[model samples]
Target: MWIADQWKDYEVIDTSDGEKLERWGDYMLVRPDPQVIWNTAKKHRGWKKPNAHYHRSNKGGGEWEFFDLPDIWQVHYKTLTFRLQPFQFKHTGLFPEQAVNWDWVCGRIQKANRPVKVLNLFAYTGGATLAAASAGAAVTHVDASKGMVGWAKENAAVSGLTEAPIRWLVDDCVKFVERE
Candidate 1:
């Protein structure tokens, strides 16, 4: 399994009782993680007074209990910027673990002497897409969900890549690939 540890804006502070304590930017959050089956000691300070805690419901969904938290926020990973909001399913509009992949792909793009073209399928929020564009590659970001594509666009603008060479498309990955 590839675990992304090279992150400056996000960190897993601790895990306990089927929950993971994470810090996104300056905000600390406690969210349920299915993989956290071990009952470890929650010794971290963030575990006790997190900015938000997602309380799971036996009925299938969950709700976030906020404590002095903003409705939305922004976080940075190196030169990339992402908007974060508490939404259904307790997502912060990003998977911070993907930072490692972004760095790896960006490095490869930079090393290549010629112009690189990237096709990001199922490009949720366009993290990799923006990373490639930021690394001087022309990128085509494709996602089935329009809302996610819009979110990715917002992230791109926030990262000062609004003028970057990116083609945003809201289409099924397979259909888009077949057309290309």
Candidate 2:
């Protein structure tokens, strides 16, 4: 198992009882985790006063119980910026763990010396596409949701990449790939 130890703005405050208490750039949130089965007491003080809690349902989905969370906000991973909001799905428009891959791909693109054209399939919210664009690659970002495609455009704009050669497409990734 590869472990990362370089994140300065995120932390896992505690994990127990099938839940993870995390701190994301000043906001503490508690969310469910199927990997954690031990019912240990949360030692972190943030766990007692998380800004939001995601409660799971027996029927298959879940809901968020917010405390002092804002309706929307922004965060950064190095040079890339992202909008964060508590949505019906347990997502905040950004996946920080993928920063490692972003850095790797960006480095490869920067060193390639040739014009790089990237096709991003299943490009939810365009994180990978934005990363490639930031690294000076022309990218075609494809997703099924128009809203997600719009959000990705906004993220690109926030990262000062609106003029980057990125083609945003609202289409099913599998179907698009098959057609291509």
Candidate 3:
């Protein structure tokens, strides 16, 4: 069980009633979590008046109710910066728990004596790509969605990795893998 406890800009405040209240930078968001089965008391005040709430529908989809939330926001993890936006599937474009993975990715690339090349497939928002690039790896980030690839580019720029060796490609991972 890897715990991502190094986050200063993101925190899981509390969990209750199939929902997790999270603090992303300056905003609080209530999102659904299937693992939170226990009906714990929602002691956190952020649960009541969060900046945004993703209400899940029993019909197989959900909708976000906003309360003064911006269309986009930024969060930092170590030397990386990620742009977050609540899109389909209740995703905020970035997964805070993946910070642990990012740390491992960075460490592996840094430990490599020579220049390393990383191929990130289905690289949603380029979390791992940025991590590898920050550690001096030339990374090729591939994703199926063009918007997601663009979003990753913006994140790279904000994280000061715009000059890093990264190749952004918008392509289906399966097809790209087969073609490559």
Candidate 4:
């Protein structure tokens, strides 16, 4: 198993009784996880008083209970950036796991020495787009959600990559790919 020691703006504090305690940047949150079946003693006080909690419903979906959290906040992943917002679902618009992939892609692009043109399909919030742009590559970021595209733009701005050659497109990924 490959273990990653480097994590950007995210941390797994603890896990117990089908739940995970995590710290995203400065905000701490508790959410359910079926993989965490082992009951463990919680040591961190933050777990008891999370800024937000995700309660799973008996039906299918779940909801977030906010104790005290801002409407929106900012976090950074190296040169890439993201906005964290509490929504109906347990999502903060950015996936920290992709940092490994971003590093690989950026390295490859930099080593290529040629002008790289990348097409990022289903580019949610522009994490990959920003990574590629930061590596000095032109990118076409496509997503189905307009709000996600807007969020990506915000990320680009925060990363100081607004002038990077990134073309944002909001359209169905399948249809767009088929037309190409």
Per-prediction TM-score, please? 0.94, 0.93, 0.98, 0.94
> Lowest lDDT 10-mer window, candidate 1?
1-10
Q: Which stretches of candidate 2 lie over 4 Å from their true place?
A: 1-6
Residue-level lDDT of model 3, residues 1-180, one tens digit each, is 999999999999999889999999999999999999889888788988999999999998899999979999899999999999998889999988988998998898888899999999999998999999999999999999999999999999999999999999999999999999
lDDT of 1 at 28: 97
Q: Rate residue 121 of model 2 by lDDT.
A: 82
Candidate 4, superposed: residue stretches over 4 Å from native: 1-4
Question: How much is 101 displaced in model 4, in angstroms?
Answer: 1.0
Winner by lDDT between candidate 4 and candidate 2 = 4
Worst 10 residues of 4 by lDDT: 1-10
Better of 3 and 4 by lDDT: 3
The parts of candidate 3 lying over 4 Å away from their true place are none
- The candidates, ranked best first by TM-score, are 3, 1, 4, 2
lDDT per residue (tens digit) for residues 1-180 in model 2: 434345676667789999998877779889888999899978788778899999999997899999999987777777877777878767777767776777778999999999999998878877799889999999999999999899899999888999999999999988998899
Cα error of candidate 4 at position 103, Å: 1.1
Instruction: Compare the candidates by TM-score and give the number of the best one.
Output: 3
Candidate 3 RMSD to the real structure: 0.8
- Tens digit of lDDT per residue, candidate 4, span 14-120? 99998989888888989888899899888899888999999999896699999988888887777777887867567777777777788888999999979999999
Candidate 1: deviation at residue 108, Å?
A: 1.1
